[model samples]
Structure formats: structure tokens, C-alpha cells
Target: MGRAPCCDKANVKKGPWSPEEDTKLKSYIEQHGTGGNWIALPQKIGIIHIHITHYYSSNPIYLSPPIISFSKQINFSISFFVFGLRMFISESGLKRCGKSCRLRWLNYLRPNIRHGGFSEEEDNIICSLYVSIGSRWSVIAAQLPGRTDNDIKNYWNTRLKKKLLGKHRKELQARNKGNGGILKQENSSSLLLQQNSAQQLHPCWPQIPVLPLSSPYTNQSPSFNDQDSIRKLLIKLGGRFSDDYQPILDGLNLQFPHGSNSLSSTQQIQEEQVHVGSSALGCMNSIGHNQVQFGQSNEYCAELVQGQGSFITTAIGEMVSSNDYSRRLLGGSLEFFYGEEMITDNKIMGACASSSCGQSTNWGETSSSLMYPSLVASNYEGVRQEMPRECAFQELSYPGAQ
Candidate 1:
């Protein structure tokens, strides 16, 4: 047989509490203490614990304005208007359990209660805690002052999860672009292989070499520039160079789930490396790898690394203007062909390298067609696995890292 209800179901009023009931509860509590037993407190006031017979999903029983004014007059602002309304509504003989009453008092009615607007530091702490300890919100809440376990739980459910998911989505999009969009909807492996082979025949751009942290060709000077290090750091951080660079960094960060899931194995890493290498090369026109150099100008590379100036447009424009002969031959500014926004400042002007630049770039398609659910699952696991190693030399820690 089922256990009986905690409170008397026949007598106690239930559902949303009206403003009048709230005022009565608040007034009595201020004048006289709860008398240690919450179960007996409702009857102490004139509010009767009558059973709620009718229920309406959209009913406006939570009328707050009149009660808010009454609360202000009594100086019961310590409870906060919303908190006082909910707390007394149940405990004031409206049908709610003693346990719920206690919870409301502790979580909402408490004097030191903190609510609304989690700071960035708070966000990071929450994310880090979540990463380290899954969803033990009570434990997480302890680290944050004035934050209740319920608040953290609700925040995580409603906001934080979506933020993480969005990060994963952007990473996946980057990887997909890096992978030549091979991760598109394909049922079978053979078709994927066939598409992969087809893509190989048409060389779009020169390869971006992934180099190790230390190289023997080092001119060991007192202050030597590490362009490779800077590039690796930027890419791994999802276009973020540092805290100040967040605005330009956009939807980028070094957030990848760790442990055995999608990207746990060495084979997967190698596959992703190969895919990104080829796909990054595929974004540009056929230029021999040695002939094409990115940011040959030390000044420009430094600016790019430091997140200074219109580094994106300048770096890319310089590379294309110097290396691509076909672009110069086309005889128009690069901005004319690819819009002002993409060009960044319109300061560096170069011609369209390919006659089919408009056709090949397909700017709208590249920017718009975002790959979603696939980026979130096992397929995205490799990104997580790879990112930690991308800047493995440096001590970088963020949420969702292994």
C-alpha cells in the first residue's frame, strides 16, 4: 500500500496562494515566532488549512501588487516581495508540506538570500565546479557566497548548459570547416570516403603546418618571438588571446570534454589532424605550400598575436596580395569582391585571386550553414582530445577541459 500524504489532504488549501493569505502569514510571523513547529503555526494565525477542490493551470491566484504594498508598509522587505508571497502563501494554511515550508524559509525567506545576475567569475567558478564534479549543485553552491543550491541548479539547467552547448557548436563548426565539411549527413562510411577522395583532387589552399612547441632551428636570443606558439595559443583558445580579447574572440574557447567518449583514442586524433590540415588548405586557391607564407611581416604577426588593430584583414590581405598573382591580375579591391565586413577595415585592397572567387568562396553558405547536433556528440569528442594537446606546453585551464 502507498504511504499517506505528509499533511492532511482533506483540510489544507493547495495550489497558488492569494495575496490576502500571504499578508496574514507575514504579519503573524513578524509579531510571533513560528513557535518551533511549522505544522502548528498556520492555525495560530486565522488562516485555515482548507483543502483546494478546484485547480486551474492558468489561474491568477498569485496576486502580488496588493500584498507587495502591505509587505512594504510592515517593513517585511527582508523576505523580498516574491519570497514573502510564496513562503507565507504555503505556510499560511495554503496546502504545502512542512518540509516545503522549511525549504522556502531557508532558501528564499532567509535574510542573506542572494538572487539574480551571476557575475563572470561566478560563471567560471560554476563551470569549473560542474566540470570537476558533474551536477552536485549543493557542493558547487558552497563555494559561492550568498548563492543557494536551488539557484545554482536552476541557472545550470536554464543557462549554463546552453552556453556550453553553443561553445561546442562553434568548435564543431570550426572543425567541420577544418574537415572540409566531410562530417555532413552521410549514412555510410563508403560515401564519406568517396567524398573525401573527390575533395582531394581540387587543391584550394596551401597547408597550415601544425608545429611542435620547441624546434632546433631556434636562434636562442634573450627576447625571441614565438609566432607558432602565439598561433597555437589563439587557435586552441577558440580565437581568444586573453580576457581582454573576448569581444573579438567571439564564440571561441578551449572547452572540450575529457575522458573516454568521442575523442579518447590516438587514431581519432590523427584522423582529425589530417582532416583539419587538408580542409584548412582547401579554403584558399591552389597555392604551393612553400610559396604561400602567412604573416611574413613580423610586425603584422605580432599585432595579430597581441589581438591589436585589424589584424585579421591586414594579415590575410597581406598574404593574398603578396602571394596570389591572379588576385593582382583581376584589377579590383578585395573588398569589392567580398564585402566590407569580411575585409575588416578596407585598408588593405587586393584583387580577387580566382576568377571563380565569388562562386568558390560562397560566403553566405560557409557562414550560415551551422552544423549542430553532430558537433555535440561523439563526433566532437576529438576536438576536446586535440585542444588540450594544442597548447599542451602552456598551463591553460578553462571549463570542460580534460
Candidate 2:
């Protein structure tokens, strides 16, 4: 009940086609044409038939069919132009399949078939079409004249994909290098700031005080009336500014200049006009016009006695007198930090005492100038032995809280 064979297996030789066989197949199709039947064409073209062995019954089976009458020549010509030419040659003579003969003619032997290297524009078109439609190489090939789907597919795999990968890898490497350089520069600046701060502290002070030097958040002109939040932040930072360190404002209650009187009371810091510098001591005006308190406190002499052991009088003197140093702290916004090793020495207390002596125009400026020298000076000291264990937040808070 199995279907009959298409051709005699023994007579049909299957493998590479010879030049003579190619010529014969090509010549026959050119002269007489396929006659519309591939199965019969092999016999008509002088391919010998032989018996094929049947496996189930161990018997030989032979298959042959009669050739049909030829169609009208006009119909054949129209079909030939539309479908292109065809060939039917079994492996017995030509050693090539009928399909193989058709492909050889259409791809190579057909009229106006150009074969060679693809141009740059064609390559671009192919790549764009492939990307848009995906790997439908035949569709891409149609857009690119004189190119085959197989050729386009092979070129993309062997050439274009590698080219694109190389470019992408180079871009990625360059991006990484830029990022690495930025990180290196930031680290270097931070280290340099710490070193300079360490060098500024006078040697006489016993324990150092640490401060948050700079961060992105500190660079901005923050909303000023948030004194409640500022106070809370300070309280959270171990009550450094809450009681023990609050400035004793004596006789000086400096009023703000004409238009700036609402500073810190009702008006917020002007964000656009504010510019942050290294120490933040110069930009106090941006904090909004508010009352700045200064005092001459002879009563704090008992309080000064506690820091007398570690206080450097000369260091406090120079620090209080330096308008430049005071200006630097006021130049930027207040930034708080935690868990840095700062030496809490008496030089800071001495500076605070010295600051109380001045009836200053800007109390915010004077207080910061007094506080940060100790903060900066404390950073370089040995934290393991000298730093106290009592406070939860051991580092400096913003000077504005003072």
C-alpha cells in the first residue's frame, strides 16, 4: 500500500554534478524546456531507469508513467516568463536534483543577475531593513538590488555583527574610563580637604573636634525658617548646641540691614542668589535678614574654667581676629555629619570665649568662625584614645544652630 517511487533509485546517481552533466541539463532545458513534468523529464532526457529493491517483501519494484500531451505554446511561454525557466535532471545522468538545476539557472544563469561585492549603500540598506523587519533576509534582499537572501545573511553574520560589536565595546570602555576619572578626582579632593583641615589646628589643644566638611546637600541654600528642624537635628546630634554650647549673647543684638530684616524669621534663603564656597563662612547674608546676637560676657569666666586646661589662648586670639576665616564659614550652608573622629580640645572653648568678647555685627559669622577651627582641628587627632564615648552623634553640626 506504500506510494510508488518517483524514479528508479539504482539508475539515479546522487552526488556532485559534473561539468558535462551541468551542460547537458542546461542545454536540454534551453532547447526543449521542462515540458511541465519534472518526473517524466528525467526519462525523456535519456536517463536510464532500473528496478528499486523493496524492503518489506524482499522483492524489486519498478515505477514508470506515460508522458502527458504538451500544453499550448502561448501558455507555456507566458508561464515561462512569469515563473522563469525550469529543469528536470535526476542524479542518474546529471547527478543533480531538478530543484538544484532551477536554482543554478535563476541565481547564476538568469538574465541581468549581477554578482560581486556589495556596495556601502546596499550594505546600509540591508542592515536597516534587517533591523526593522528582523531576519527576513529575502525581504531585505528585495530592497537591495542584485543581492541574494543567502548572501545578505552570510555578510551580516560574518561582517556587520562583528563590526557593530567592536564599536559598542569601544564606547563602553570610554564611558567607564570617564566614570573612573570622575571618581578618582572626587576622592582626591576629599582627601586634600581633610589634610588641609588637619594642618590648620593649633598643636596646644588637647582633644580635637570633628565636623562635617562638605557634601552636595551642604552646597545648597536651604530654606532658613526651618529652625525647628535645625534644632531637632542638633538635638539628635547629641545636644552639642542645645545647652552646653549655646552662645551667651550679652549686650549685642544686631539688627538686620534695611531690606533684609526678615531673615530667618519670615523669609527663606534666596536660592538663586546663594553661592557656596569652601568653608561656608562668607555667605551669611543669604540666610535671610534676621537678628544676629553678640555679647560681652564676663559672667562665663566660670564656664571658661572647664576648658582652661586644654585651651590655647594665642590660637583662640588669632582665630577670633581672622575676618577671613570667619568669612569662609559663612560662605556656605550648614551641613551636619556623624561618626567622624574629631578631637574635642579646649582651644575650641577658648575660641568660643574669645568670640563672646566681641559685640559683633554678625553673630552667625562669629560663632561659626569660633566653632569650625576646633571642628577642623579635631579631625587629625587620635580618635581611639582621646575621643569621648559619651555622645551618640560625635561629629559637628551646622554652625547656624549655634
Candidate 3:
């Protein structure tokens, strides 16, 4: 056999709850806590027992036997609800189901139930958590103290989602404008590598590569406030850029997942050590080895450690900036690399002065590259790259050190 219904469906009132009903439900729950029974709760308020439904339909319920006690089930504060306004049934009880009374108190009449006015902080928390956890509204609601799961779900569907989508569209439009707009490159700094390029072409004027209009923004959807962190990082690593500084950073935007399924991209430039996306720039680590690698091409590579004033040196301490003044103003962030196979031909790349740490520096010919910025550029007198090489301590331009 199946379970019986909690109450008589037709006898119960239905529709918007009246203030009287609200007061009754709230007061009863506060006082007795439903005594753990919804059906019995309303009866406690003054419901006359309708023992015989057929007898009450034709005349007075008193003709039927009175029901002093209800069937099984206990210990839950419950009340039924509906859309109706009427005088309080002082003689009869609230005509609502157990579920209705529970919902009325939890959703509306309860204290601290925020109806609306979601703040920007709440919005970010919602957006970030949603991006990470999807449409888990109950879980999301738990994060917002005064918010309810239903309220959040409805808000996301009706408002917040549209807001994010509109912003996403604006970003797309702006990105399109960039394809043929503000980013036209106008200068290039060919760092003094070995010797400056001697082309009659203006070394100061740059040849910025024109990109197509269809390229998408690198980050999926990042919040606007993340800009402060990004700005600080960019300034810290500002000198790290060669000529492509504008373009690379231009592509970087802090992103949140614009769509429920879109992936969130995370980048960190503020760490004690710098890291960014590029085939040419990378940091490597092993048991006791830490190497920062940079190059013009995949086939071309070289190793560098911090040196005095905007410069990097070979694994065995050699001035990367082949000449004098170029050594100070721009350091050795720029380098000329050759192939490992040519280590003995003496055709290119300076030979190691005195091999340190029993390791040899190999230089491969690459077309374009830039390395780490001077750590303590303020005092360029010299730098010490934290690596595992004894010769790493030699002073720049020291006898045969270069």
C-alpha cells in the first residue's frame, strides 16, 4: 500500500499568503517550532477536527466524530501555504500543507532574508565560484550569508548572466578595433648584441607586425578589478620586454569564465621570480639546478645569470653585452647565440674562460631574443645569478671574465 496524503487538498486555502497567515506561521514556528509536525501544527492553532468529510459537506462538521489526534509522522516545523487574504480563522487552523508553511518561513517571513540589492563583491564571489563550480546554486548560496539558493539561481538566470555576456560582447568589439587600431608599432630597440645592427634603416623606427581582425582575446573572461595586480607586475617586469613588449602585454587580460563552460585562465607575474607564456622565455628546475632559458628560435638557446646593471652572463661569468657603454644602459638581456655543435670550431661564441661547476655554456644561433631584467638595476655595479656555478661570482668585464 502507498502512504496517505497529509491533508484534504480541497479544504486547504491556496494562493498568496495573507499577513494574518504569515504572522500565525512565523509566531507558531518561533514559539513551538512546529512541535516537529506540519499537519498537527495548524490544528494546534485552532483547527476543528473534520472527522467525517461527507457529513461536513452537507452540514456542520460537528455532526461527525472529532479528530483529536493526527496520523503518524513527527518533529518537523511544517505549514502549507497559498495565495489568499482573509480574516484569521481564530476558530479554525491555517489551511496550508506542511511544505507550504516551511517554505513561507524559510523564503519570505524569515528574518534576514535579503530580497535583492546584490553588491559588486557578492557578484564577483558568485561569478568566480560559478566559473569554478558551475550551476551549483545551493553551494554558491552558502557563500553569501543573507542570500538564498533560489534567489541566487533566479538572479543568475535573469540578471547576472546577461550582464557578463554584455561585457563579453563589448570586449570582443574592443579587441576587433585593436586589430587595425591603437597598436601600430612605431619603435624598436635593437639591444647592443656583440655590436649594433648597422642597416641604413632607422633603428629607432619599428616594424610592428599587423595582425588579422579575427584574433580572439587571450583571456576567456576576467573581472575588471584584477587590473591593479596586473599593472604592478607589468611595471616590475617592464624592462624585461624587448620590442614586442606592447603586443605581448596587450594580449594579456585577466579573465574569468565568460560562459558557464568557458575555461578560466590564470597568470602570475607578481611572484618573487617572473613567469609568463612564451616559447623563448622559461624557467627550469631540477634536484639542485635552476636555469632561466631564453632564445630567438627553438633551435637557438643560451643560459644567463644576473649581472651588474641590466645584464646577464654566461654560465661561467662572461659579459653578455660584448662592448663597454652597452654594458650599462641596456645590460646583456640581449645575446648572440650559436649552435652547440660549433663549441670547438671557434668560428662563433666566446670560449669559456675557466669552466666552472664542471659545466660548459653552449650558445646556439637564434634570430631574436631578450632575457631577465637586472634584479637590482639600481646598483648595476654587478649581479649574482642564483645558480649552481662556482664561476657565477666573477665580476663583469673582469680579466677574461668577458
The backbone clash count of each candidate, in order, is 6, 28, 26
Query: Which is the winner by lDDT between candidate 1 and candidate 2?
Result: 2
Query: Rank order by lDDT, top first?
Result: 2, 3, 1
Model 3 / residue 288 / CA error / Å: 33
Q: What TM-score goes with each of the models?
A: 0.34, 0.30, 0.35
lDDT of 3 by residue, 217-286 (tens): 2332223244445444434333432232322223233232244111111111101111111121111011
Q: lDDT of all predictions, in order shown?
A: 0.35, 0.35, 0.35
lDDT of 1 by residue, 265-300 (tens): 322332321111111121111111211222121121
Highest TM-score scorer: 3
lDDT of 2 by residue, 48-80 (tens): 222344233333232232122222211121111
Model 1: lDDT equals 0.35
Q: How many backbone clashes does candidate 2 have?
A: 28
lDDT over C-alpha atoms for residue 232 of model 1: 47
lDDT minimum window of 10 residues, candidate 3: 281-290
Candidate 2 yields a Cα-based lDDT of 0.35
Better of 2 and 3 by TM-score: 3
